[model samples]
Target: MDWDFLIDIFQQLLGGVPLTLQLSLLALVAGFILAVVIASAASSRYRLFRWIASAHIEIFRGTPLLVQVFLIYYGLGQIPGLRQSVLWPFLREPYWCAILALALNTSAYTAEIIRGAIQAVPASEIEAGRACGMSGLLLRRRVTWPIASIEQGQQGRCNSAVP
Candidate 1:
């Protein structure tokens, strides 16, 4: 290829960096929120909640991301009443579909990371927090949350570097 032509192509590709970053960041935030919910549910005291969360994680994680994207983007439109619904306007857009797919996919992976991280926290730390008059949300916030956050950060870095 000509040097100038290669440089022009590179420049054009560079123009898409902002969009890529925007999508990644949006997905990251959405996924993190969803992951936290799923992880909480999975670890809940109620069997029903644990079952529901487990099913959600299994369904999402078992499927290919591309398949999920196509199903969300194209399959929804095929439903008889979906096209006429008020939500159709937003669903018809590719931007939302892509974001939804990315968010869902990322959430599944992130949920597993979070669940593992939470489980990895030492029991003694939680006990210590309780002994200090910290219980329920307070104990989690002070003891478990910090350790899990670090694990999440490490896992996120490793995942991002992979293909």
Candidate 2:
């Protein structure tokens, strides 16, 4: 084995750590927000919102991240109106494209995880919260969200090998 050559390549790769960390953190934050929105939509009473959220999750989850990146970075420019829009400047950049792809992909997975976690919360606990005068957003914020967060944490640890 070429130990010296391997070490040299590893050292070179280390130079990209800062950019990698930045992209990851950016994606994590954006994806979390997107996931929350999508999950909420999935759980909404409105059929349109549920359908749209389901479509977003299915489309992203079914496709490859590389294809998504290519589509956003190269294909978006091929569209007529988008190029003339205010977002064209940011969308044209590869860094933004990559971040968008990562955020989108992460959001799809995170949305499902969150949805499942929310569903897994016990009905008894929800009833208890209701008895305490918690309902709507307050019920979710005080009772449901914390349980779901814990569930997500455990699942995250178990599925750490994924991605």
Candidate 3:
């Protein structure tokens, strides 16, 4: 073992801490917002919207992220029209591709967690919101959302404390 070389590599890795923190924080925030959107869509009264969101969640959840990374980074890039499109600039970067894949994957998982949490919320709470003249978006944003956020925060902290 080369002690000096090992120490140098460790120091270099530490230098990347800021970038790692930035990426992780950005992904978490963006993914949370996306998850909320997905949950809302999944729970919508319209069948088409619900089906689209459900299918998105199912596909992302069912597949391993490595495959998604490959598909988004390589497969999509291989398409001639996509390569020529304005999005190609963003897609060409491996970092963004990886971030996009991770965000999408996380959003899918988070959406399920949130959806389950929302469903687990007491029906009475939603009814109470309705009685208060809060239906549609108001019921969800006021009653269900806060509960889900608390549940998610607890889950996140628990998961982080684990090995």
Residue-by-residue lDDT tens digits, candidate 3, 1-91: 9999999999999999998887778778888899989988898899998998899899999999899999999898889999899999999
Clashing pairs in model 3, backbone N/Cα/C closer than 3 A = none
**lDDT of every model, 2 decimals:** 0.89, 0.95, 0.86
What local lDDT does model 2 show for residue 106?
Answer: 96
- Summed backbone clashes in each candidate are 0, 0, 0
Q: Report the Cα lDDT for candidate 1.
A: 0.89
Q: Please identify model 2 stretches exceeding 4 Å from their true place.
A: 1-7, 154-163
The C-alpha stretches of model 3 lying farther than 4 A from their native spots are: 150-163
- Residues forming the 10-long window of minimal summed lDDT in candidate 1: 154-163
TM-score of predicted model 3? Answer: 0.84
Provide TM-scores for the models.
0.83, 0.88, 0.84
lDDT of 1 at 65: 92
Best by TM-score: 2
- Per lDDT, the best of the predicted structures is 2
Q: Judging by lDDT, tell me the better candidate of 1 and 2.
A: 2
Which residue pairs clash in candidate 1?
Answer: none
